[model samples]
Target: MFRKWESPEAVFHLLKACSKGMPCDITGIDDYRMIDEKRGIQWPLPDGHPIEPLSERRLFEDGQFYTPDQRARFVFEAPRPLPEPTTSAYPLTLLTGRGTSSQWHTQTRTGKSYVLRKLHPNVPYVEVSPKDAAELGIRANEWVIVRSQRGQVKARVFVSHVVQPGQVFMPMHDAATNQLTFAAFDPYSRQPSYKACAVRIEPAPVGRSNHSALPALNLFIASLGE
Candidate 1:
């Protein structure tokens, strides 16, 4: 079995040199010590530099960039079609984003907080427009199966006007949410196109429960801490 390091500082010291040439100047162990003294300073501070007062500091104020021309560059290209298009089988567009300000990605740590979990929905849910839910015979809080070309998962139905007809919204905190996302990426930036995908929603089988194990486990752990 793999052994854990004595402490995080031990690991940081081993990888300190790797930070060289990065945008941030946290290239040395001493720079990290400044965190306690300066209450955290923005990068680009070389050794022997004095800490600036804690305040917002923007970079590239002179409109200079790291490119060879020392100027910013822009790329323009013709619009490309979505990797997955809506079809008769998958007639709705699905979008995913942050569930709440208190919850972060995956909710591995944020989910542990009782206050944060209480502020947001405890279970995974998809927001569907009233028109779509009514047409599909889906009721609020009923379990629904959302399917895409890639995969599908069960989520509770939340009939809300926040989403428009022919579209649905799912929070990104659930692991199952990404099972349906397309792997297609932008050619220029190589960023995955996670915002758009074709999906279809149907009511889950009778007597099916919408509760997820992870959230329930997290709540149980939080209760133990109380």
Candidate 2:
């Protein structure tokens, strides 16, 4: 189906088929030479557009809009209820995000590099606040099962003050995180959310600890990644 999609000719035709006029019209960029000479063509460059530096073609130069009233439209949406609110059964809020610079989402490609693998923790782990850890009898580097209404994942625990007492964080890079994430989508954008969910953590059984296998977190340098 995508036979020649990589060719410039295919891209030009595809852009024309879905062009939205001024906002993203780029049917003018029909040739590879045009692209090479232009360095890069800013969007809305319809066919026969005058030659100018790509950045020089500014939008709304007259401070106006195409609307009948010549004004921009703003979208407002009422806040929706939390997808998975915390309850007595699941008291802690779970936050999932990037954990290291060496890894990308799901670590699909970055995980294969030997040097990158050595730069971050090899096993999946969840961050728990010291207060919650003490209350739940969770020690650092201990295996704990993070359970949500959707599912659960076994993660090594890293108790620190980074997270609030009632909240925990897991790296989105781990493939297993999706197993416990609640599937919820926004009404307007129809985008799925992965930021928050309600879950509870409990230490795994006694034998779950591997004294010599699992490496303890470098809590002193808590700046894992952005």
Candidate 3:
């Protein structure tokens, strides 16, 4: 059971076998030994290739290319228009991205650290341009609901000049933020194109709670103070 690929060491051994003849071959690594030694191994260490961790190694030092003609190749394509553009209904471009160094994708592991938790705000907040906030009657730290064709998310108003009048920024750390993202994907790579979506903002009802989608997060933050 321990030898199964589900184990960490077994997975590395399987990876080594899969990369046997590839440029990223990792044959020099041993099971669990690298961790105990606090050492690392650079890949392409193909069974006989000699290199050490942190050492300078160049892939194409011989001035050769992998192309059929042994020369470099470059490709270009015309720029594509945004699939979800801002309209009169959803008049603002909702930009979703990391808010701070302390926050990460979904806050799965970082949210566990008390010190990391304190670095960023516990409540979800949206960065709106001063121009938009004034036009929408949104006050600083006031509860606001952002809506898109897909869904909606509640966030506090953070009026700043960082964003333009036609744009608003929301941190992707909250799972609810995904509900408002555009559900588009690249045809070639199949990678999700969710960075930008058309959404509109309005002042939430006066009695809205601070918590958006994850109430447990507020509880977790409260426990830290005790």
Candidate number with greatest lDDT: 2
- In order, candidate lDDTs are 0.77, 0.78, 0.77
Q: In model 3, what is the error at residue 63, expressed in angstroms?
A: 7.2
The TM-score leader among the candidates is: 1
Which regions in candidate 3 have their CA more than 4 angstroms from the true location?
Answer: 1-24, 35-38, 52-54, 59-73, 211-226
| Decoy 1 TM-score against native | 0.81
- lDDT (Cα, tens digit) per residue for candidate 1, span 61-106: 7687878898887999998888888999999999999866878988
Off by over 4 Å in 2: 5-24, 31-36, 57-71, 77-81, 108-115, 205-226
Model 2 CA RMSD to the hidden true structure, in angstroms: 4.4
Name the weakest run of 10 consecutive residues (lDDT summed) in model 3: 216-225
The Cα RMSD in angstroms, rounded to one decimal, for candidate 1 relative to the true structure is: 5.4
Question: What lDDT score is found at residue 3 in candidate 2?
Answer: 75
Q: Write the per-residue lDDT of candidate 3 for residues 44-118, one digit (tens) a residue.
A: 577766655568777767666767786766657589988899999999998989877887898999988888876
Candidate 1: list runs displaced more than 4 Å. 1-4, 28-33, 54-57, 62-64, 68-70, 211-226
